[model samples]
Structures are given as C-alpha cells and as structure tokens.
Target: TKMLRHGEVHGKPLTSKQKGLFGLLAGGGKPTRLKKKRDRRLESR
Candidate 1:
C-alpha cells in the first residue's frame, strides 16, 4: 500500500520498515548463535 503510494505518487521506493525487515531476513533474522552460546555458558559454569 505505502510502496504503491510512494512509487505511483510520492516517487520513493519503499518504507524503512520494509527495508529493515528485508535486511533482517537477509542477515538470518534472529541471533543464530543464541542456543550455542547458552550451552557454552552452562558448560563453563
């Protein structure tokens, strides 16, 4: 909706939210090492 408005009328590409979400996905979204780090910490304790 907003992207359509931007390109059709406002002339921008996309919103910041869309860009951020894309970036997050491209970068693998969540912290991939979370469980590994937790296990390592538990082992050290």
Candidate 2:
C-alpha cells in the first residue's frame, strides 16, 4: 500500500525496478521488466 499511497506522493518518478519491488511486496504480482523508451524531446543536441 505504501507504493500506491506514498510512492508518487513526493512528486517524483519511480524507476521500473522500484515499481516492481513495490508490486511484489504488495502482493500484486511478479516484477515486470520495464522497457526504456527514448524520449525524442529530451535528446541532446
């Protein structure tokens, strides 16, 4: 419940690994492999 109730409450983004760990502890399911998507908008010149 901490994940859902307090994870994002700080206005910070949580990494995939953190999400997976939280999910597991919360009895939601297995840890999911998160894919890294390239953000074109953030690409450096």
Candidate 3:
C-alpha cells in the first residue's frame, strides 16, 4: 500500500517547488513575514 513519509507520497518525495504548492493547497502556507519582537528598553528610545 502507498504511504506518506516526511511530506512525501508513495515512494516519491516532493520537490522544493511542489512542496510550496502543496503547502498552500493544504492551507499551511508560511506567512509572508514573521512578526518581530520589540524589547521593552527599545520602546523607550
């Protein structure tokens, strides 16, 4: 029977390009940018 392994289907692995497309299709696409944390001391500057 075919199985999934490490983000792969059957015995074939997903390529970098396909991974991105699949991620979006699976609704797990990465955010465009991460939110940066601001230090409390920096807020006063």
Taking all chains together, each candidate's TM-score versus the true structure is 0.37, 0.43, 0.41
Predicted model with the maximum TM-score: 2
Cα RMSD of all models vs. native, in order, equals 8.9, 8.5, 10.4
Task: Spell out the clash pairs found in candidate 1.
Answer: none
Candidate 3 per-residue C-alpha lDDT over 1-45 given as tens digits, one digit per residue, 9 for 90 to 100: 122237677767878766766565467655343223345446779
Residues 1-45 of candidate 2 have per-residue lDDT tens digits of: 775656674789677767767777688564334212334335644
Model 2: lDDT of residue 40: 39
Local distance difference test scores for all models: 0.60, 0.61, 0.55
As a whole number from 0 to 100, the lDDT of residue 15 in candidate 3 is 82
Superposed Cα deviation of residue 44, candidate 2 (Å)? 48
Q: Candidate 2: which pairs clash?
A: none
Q: What 10-residue stretch in candidate 2 is worst by lDDT? A: 32-41
How big is the positional error of residue 40 in model 3, measured in Å on the Cα after superposition? 54
How does residue 21 of candidate 1 score in lDDT? 56
User: Candidate 2's error at 35, in angstroms?
Assistant: 27
Kindly give the stretch of ten consecutive residues in candidate 3 with the minimal lDDT sum. Answer: 31-40
